[model samples]
Target: MGIITGVIGHWGWEVEDYLLDVWEAHRTPIILATSSILICVWLYLYFSEEREGLVALPRQYTVETKRTSPFQLSNPLPTTKPKVVGEKATTVGPKRIRGEIPRQTTQKESPKRDGLEIQVLVFYSSLTGKTEKAVKDLVEVSQEEINGAGTGTCRFPDAQILDLSEIDYDEYFINPPKREDGKAVDYFYLLLLPSYNIDTINDTFLEHLKETHNDFRIDSAPLSNLVGYSVFGFGDREGWPTEEDGYGFQAKEVDRWMAKLTGRKRAFPLGLGDLKMDGKARLLEWSSGLIDVLRMFAQTGVLGDGVRGSGDADESDGEYASDEEEDTETSIEGNEKPTKNKGSIDDVEDLGKMVAPSEKAPLAIDFTTYGKSKPVNIQTPQAKEMVPKTSPTYAALTKQGYSIIGSHSGVKICRWTKSALRGRGSCYKYSFYGINSHQCMESTPSLSCSNKCVFCWRHGTNPVGTIWRWQVDPPDLIFSGIKEAHYKKIKMMRGVPGVRAERFQEAMRIRHCALSLVGEPIFYPHINEFVGMLHAERISTFLVCNAQHPDQLAALKPITQLYVSIDAADKESLRRIDRPLHRDFWERFQRCLEILREKRFKQRTVFRLTLVKGFNIDEAVKGYADLVDKALPCFVEIKGVTYCGTSTSSSAGLTMANVPFYAEIQEFVEALNHELNSRGLEYGIAAEHAHSCCALLASARFKKNGKWHTRIDYDRFFDLWEERGPDGDWTPEDYMGEETPEWATWGNGGFDPRDTRVDRKGRKIEV
Candidate 1:
């Protein structure tokens, strides 16, 4: 080893020098060749690893083993652990690392079942707890009725009652709830809603339904999954005496919304009840009807014949059609049979031999007469009854509280009559005229009308015709029938709470007749005779016409007052507002105005202008003033349109927004009065009924000394009518009553002082 060390020491310097020279010369080439070789080795290693199915570990998963000590014992654990059997393995991949592991699909498959079990959900909204109590009673009654229905293919479980104020709208309204146990189940919704003028949960629920229907992201009818639905509403009749006055308004709105949401699956017509009077009875009746409908659905799975399913909104409880008549008409149209000859041919002698026997002869034409002569002994077609008992029109009118009289006439107890009986107040007629509301009989001789006004509270249920073509009932029969019906309806109100004993007794005897119940009173062929019949009984007559029938308006009748409905001030506006059926409606209206001008001295002429906000209120002052100047009526009654919660109105784009507020009405009235006065028209704002949103403008002729004399003297009117026949000359001043009441005058509110005003909850409202 020493000899080798001495030799290496001697050659070390020479070997180091030789190596340094070789390194300096080949440095560049050596670096290039090494890089190339390293690259080729790396490519070959990568390809070999790929072929062996090896993958580079991600940075996050790269394990760095730190050796605490080089001498530390080698870990005994294997790098790859064996998977345990029956254990849910953790997902380990790009998807898992990116947090995108697939989730179970939300799309659920409907379970197939043998039969449908109907689950009835009774929903209610109450403000004063009255509806809550009613709902409890209804649920109990419904449960009993369903239990009594016996077992069948469709089984009904216990009914569920839900308070609308507490329920989540999205859970039920957006789509029907899914059964957790996966059974074929159908749901029926029954809503009991109490209307309140003030804010309530009902408004919020209604808004949700509207938004859901209008939402673009959802189907327009999301609740179409529901089998059926119905609604019953409770309201205070004393505060809101009519549907047009917001009685049961919320319930109606709910029914309408449900109809839309359920694709017109209104299983039953809406039932409205007066909370203080027939609320329970109506609820029971509605429930009974609903139980019948449920049975029908279970047995047939169809809403019976004549029942509107997925169609128009139901406006009445009953619907009927004359199948026999329809079949006959269809047969006649299909057969095309030749009409029988009315008379013998005049030229029969010329073709005596050629003519066959009379019985076997073909329909012969009379050459001499040709088409110039009318057919002799040709029986005229029989006139049809205006409102048949089995007709839809009759059912609709009865449902709306009208008692039909004769075939063509009807009599109804006005809301004002009920209010007056309950000492709530009277209609605007009572404020302008001295007619006792409870003692007034509101009747119409003809139920057929000429116009379908947009503000018609009847919801297009009343029949419309351009002419009187129905069978005419005798005037005497109509008069008596109307009186009996009126008295009967009034007597039915005897058990109603808050009815004054004296007022109830006074209502038994009719002191006046209001011919403005529904239709154009002048349309009755025997209107004059009918008025005479009322006058004979000392009942003052206030006949209102649509002003479309000029001949009837001009023909004759002197009564307490004559009203011509001036719905619009211009022709185009009239067409839009009145929707008159007559082709020459404007001419007829102008002629009626001229007739009124001519009859101003003979009868108490009035122009009743129903102001619909957007349709006729804007820029209509001067036009109305011109009409007044042309007619020179004794008084002009201006009233805001009453909003009827009807599909017809909704389709016409009319809503609560179109309803003018009392303040807005006052502004319009004031503006109209200014316009009239500026045109030298001696008309003044004589009185106002703020409660009814009505204002009266009287002519100077009604002004006695310094006070306006607008109120009519019923006794004096009858006296004048009896002393001088209807055709006799008479003036409006002849039967003028005392000066207008102080409380009824302009700016005094026009509410009777004796009656107390109450809020919707029956709390006395201090004026």
Candidate 2:
């Protein structure tokens, strides 16, 4: 039956059987047969496209005749004439010789906005307006030059720029005033980025846009075009590789978004711009280029046309004379947020200045202050020199997107907060391991060591060697970098689209701790001062030091958490794994252990064994247990080395085969508990990831008699043994390896396996 309909040229349903009877019996002429065959062929082709996809092909008519590019070679440059040149002139009589005749004639009026262009909407994120300054500088050079023959004043339309922090996309971009619910004014200057991202198109950007424009569909036609209109990002090549490593990736976001608009290839890929925190010159150059792009439709007459409706043509053609006179009066301002009260406050600075009078009900909030950068170091220990909460650095970091890691508002280490990761590290729906969980402290810090261990995931590396290499950066730059890191991730997630649950929150938690970046941090001479600065902020410090600097470790006060990176059990393996710069590395490590034994130290100390598969796990663990026993640390964390950073050393930590290796070590540790028990010590299981990593915190006092030694004053013991010289060096008072303490021996004849080395004859140590 369906075939019969097809033979009659009907559509929609498919039929397996043929329409026999009448058609077969009739047998037709050549013309009729040909016509019938054509009908069948046409029907089959109809369903093919529907079955395949909805991708629409270009229309047949006028599509080809249209210009191939938005900007054509013949297009005129934007014109900013008389006003740009700051010229002023009064017309003289045409027939000056006949003086009286000229006074009777009147001059023609100029337009109110003669040389203005299309309104551009620029969405920017700036730290101390470096990015904004870049834009302004571009605007300056790109403005048109004027000659003496020019008529009246030409104009530069006051461009409308919005900081993404303040505006609501739904209110302005998606829905216009008439839409009450529909049609937003399409402003093209939407550039989004000024910081860090694991990727170019991030979850936070998508989420913010989504939440801000709740009703809009990401895949829809109009919304994507408006949001995708124009884009740019700023980032560095220091961290993990992402799509936005440079101009190439940023351009791709622009291209990808543009693809949804034109259904064609995008000509411009993202342009990567890097600032190794260099000077202002590069910024000036880049800004000028961006401004040039903005002036595209400027000379095309969008603003010139808008000016035409104004009655006074002369006034419309903004004169340079008028510009100077109206400089303070007619400066146009915009409202990024769609608040109902339009004229209540003039501008952003006005909003801030109202702080004295305390503007009530509706107030303009400033997120710009948050977008500053601050460089933290362990060197240059001048207590007063460090930035304070009220300091420009603190204000700058807090105002933008940056949040300090710890509880205190004043601490300066890598300005981070929980929101740093809205996707990858954090699962937005759940609040685990993000901003609030980060803990740090202010104390005269102590601890130093070698080895940028493979397992470490810190954002920077101190790269060991010296302190005071560079002068301290002003408060704003460091904090701005810190603050912008959060929003940058948010923007990235937004571009890529979907994110795992809770990944956002988890990422935010680790914001301030970029454990691996450049150098080894322990070499900073003023580490004590730096730590003390944080302590004043009510933050507790976790000083993770390499054992290479035990002398520096000795010259200090107690911190919140101290770590000694012990990568091996003995000297030879230590060199292979830690790659220390010292001649006698093992002895240096031993000295670190000695510092841990100091009695006055009240901080919780730790020995972190970076257990790689084959490198030094066996030696390090047993030796670490020995160090743990002698060091009398508060905790011992035996973890597998994480393979990252510049080391081509072996990926022993990351390979799948290491699973059994890690498990075997755990078994070894559990078995060692027996030895710990003999010596009245204890141990626990191992872990893999941050949360998976468990530990054993040691007891303050140990047992001597069959009963117990209830109070051995751990602090007093540390104090008397660790004596300080006038020059700030440490000398152990009664600390001697030759004299074994009572606790070194268990009830049995043998000593604890961890504290006693094979070479020693029943001696040399005890925690």
TM-score of each: 0.52, 0.38
lDDT of 1 by residue, 1-767 (tens): 99999999989989999989999999999999999999999999976764465333443333223211111112122244222223322222222111111111111111221355778899998877888998898788679777554245667888999998888899999878878997657788989888888887988998998898778677676776576787888889899865556887888778767766765556665777876898787777778767866776665554432223311211221121112211010001111221221222111011122223552222222222212333233223666777788765554455445678888888877767877876678888788887789999888888778787877765444666665556778999998898887765664453233444446556778998889887778878778888887788888888889887777777867878889999998999999988877777788889899999999998899999998889999989989989999999999999998874555577666788888888988998889899888988888999999989999999999998889999887777777777877777678888888999989999999998877776544457777
Lowest-lDDT window of 10 residues in candidate 1?
Answer: 325-334
Worst-scoring 10-residue span by lDDT in model 2: 98-107
Report the error of model 1 at residue 33, Å: 99
Candidate 1 lDDT: 0.71
Tens digits of per-residue lDDT, candidate 2, 668-701, equal 5565555566677654321122222222323433
Top TM-score model: 1
What local lDDT does model 1 show for residue 463? 64
- State the displacement of the C-alpha of residue 245, model 1, in Å, after optimal TM-score superposition: 28
- Tell me the spans in candidate 1 whose CA falls farther than 4 Å from its real position: 1-379
Instruction: Compute the lDDT for candidate 2.
Output: 0.37
Number of clashing pairs per prediction, in order: 0, 110
- Kindly report which residue stretches of model 2 are placed more than 4 angstroms away from their true locations once superposed: 1-220, 225-518, 599-601, 619-621, 645-647, 650-662, 682-767
lDDT of each: 0.71, 0.37
